[model samples]
Target: MRRIRIKLNRIPSLPERRRVGRKIMADLGIKLQMGWNPFTENIAPKAYALMFETLDKFLAVKTKDNRPDTVRGYTSYVKLFKKWLLEHGFDETSYVCSFTESDAIDFMDDRDLAVSARTFNNSILFFRVLFNWMIERKYIKDNPFMAVKRKPKRLTQKIRRLFTPEEFNELIIWLEANNVPYLVMALMCYCCFIRPKELSMLRCRDIDLDNQLIRISASIAKNEKDYTRTIPDSMMKYVRKLDLSNPGHYLFGDHPMYDFSPGTKKASSRRFASYWSYVVRPALGFPKELQFYSLKDTGITNMVNSGVPLTSVQQQADHSSLAITSIYIGKTDRASEALKAVDIID
Candidate 1:
């Protein structure tokens, strides 16, 4: 028998002790079903903390290094998950520990039925990573999303597109003639082949017109590797237009009254989404399908077609391989096509 100690309001008589033992025995079956060892564990009361608190703790540690946009995505996903848990009664004291792959699928099916393949895959990644972390620290016994299948991108609701010359010219004209502050950002995306996330982490110090280079340090780069993007001489006229006096300020941010402003801090890539929705999308009358990133596509396509070396475009794109760059080149719009054409964003 195992030695155990119990504290009570008063010394219990033998009859009272036996009565309490019976109650404990009855609860043990339920505890076992919940993945808790009632005899050896008493952690549910403090650890679960009514579910949401526990989830918040996980997020605090897990998303600390994620980009602002990614953090927001994770937070929103968690909120929806928590609401689902409350509705489905998964918020019980030890229900989190009891979660299995079946429950994970149920949540995905119920919440992600109509989401895009990218969104569905990202959600699966989030849950798998979240649960793996939990399992590592003994918070749970298994990863609930370990076996979930990814939705095929081809089958998902994707709005694939390429910018026609007419559309591209119209957009540039609109930017030059209005207060589209993201014009410079769009130019960087198109000209220098930089991603919005990378641009968000950029400071004035990174843009060196004198050297015709933009530096991406490993800390800020998505690939965790240092990269240098050349500032084409043709684009220098536009690059020179930026206010680089304050080397510490973010390159594409610092709108004085903007909600997504990263003033004195790193801005979020999410600002691009809001800017596109509230500003550019309405002004240009562009559909949701024509993403700002499509500018990068136009640039890559223009370069490869204009006889720029495959390896050269690959390096400029910071792509891991030529294969990926080739894929971008494969989806070109000749009418809206190259270097002379892109001449554009972040």
Candidate 2:
């Protein structure tokens, strides 16, 4: 099997881009035979069709949160995986139940694609989930991904992404100037130190503006336990000004500014990284690697630096283990307090 890396030449203007795209598609044909999947016993065409249809049905019916956009993304990922698998000589007709841990590991290692470890991990996890679902539903007798542990490399880069005072001010000004909502959707996770996924299921009614508190139901929180975080007094005015007439409306409702629908909101986490790249970073002149999750990191850092108790931040951050919070706090000047018996040699 031949491995080819796709290279994008410098992007031309929109008109030029459209012309290039059309020409490329024309050259490739509407549906050309890429490779054959032996599992279907048919040529490439039937196997590819079956793979897509299977993925669509699985995502649409299996996901706990059945948002349209979420399903759409899973469909796209599965398609990309199928393309990769075929090009790499993976059989499609034999149930994925025949696969093993080594197969999975080799697949990741052998790929010429220059993707991140996190992305590779996600692809493996997606396959794991897919196989698990298939096994449970009797589509297959066993799950191939059960013992396939994804041992990802340690994240060496200390995540240094947060809005400085100047950057934050620029973000606000840009939003206001463009009539975008000033409510920092990303900041809710950071300032309150909640998980990004939890923010998605939040409803307008969950917030108590009068009491300056936001309650997250146990059902939606990452820890699966009910917890409430108080909205700081400083942010109350911003909360008060928000329109919350629709009880069913999400806190991050489908605002025109964000171009989000309920479908978009469910898939927001997947899109959050891209949002910062195309919109937030460019508008604020920040680095390309800056992600929305960095907002949470900054929030935790500021809270710790300002002498907030680690225990309190842990609870707010919904960390199951105190050790995790300690890692985030790192070594602090307050370490002296813990070292009561330190002796200095002359």
What TM-score against the true fold does each predicted structure earn? 0.74, 0.61
Could you give candidate 1's per-residue lDDT for residues 1-346 as a string of tens digits? 7643432223247775566455545656677788975467643322222346557878898577777567887788889888888787665343354566787889898756667678888888888887776766656655769778888767665574768878888988887666434666777788789888888889888888789999999888888799999888877776676667788887767564443322356656787767777888788899888888888888888788777899999999988888898886546644443455785576
- Model 1 RMSD in angstroms: 8.2
* Top candidate (lDDT): 1
Name the runs in model 2 displaced over 4 angstroms: 1-81, 88-92, 95-106, 110-114, 124-160, 169-182, 257-267, 270-274, 330-346
Candidates' lDDT values, in order? 0.72, 0.60
lDDT score for residue 78 of model 2 = 72
In model 1, what lDDT does residue 233 have?
Answer: 82
- List residue ranges in candidate 1 displaced over 4 A: 1-26, 29-76, 100-102, 134-142, 146-148, 256-267, 333-346
lDDT string, candidate 2, 1-346, tens digits: 6332222233346775565456544534643455533343322211222344455568768566754546766777777767766776554432233344566566666542556556666767777788676656544554555555565468435445665667666765775455333244554666787665667677778888878778999778665678998787766665665566766776654444455333223435545555666776787778755566767776777777678898888877777777888776633323555457767767
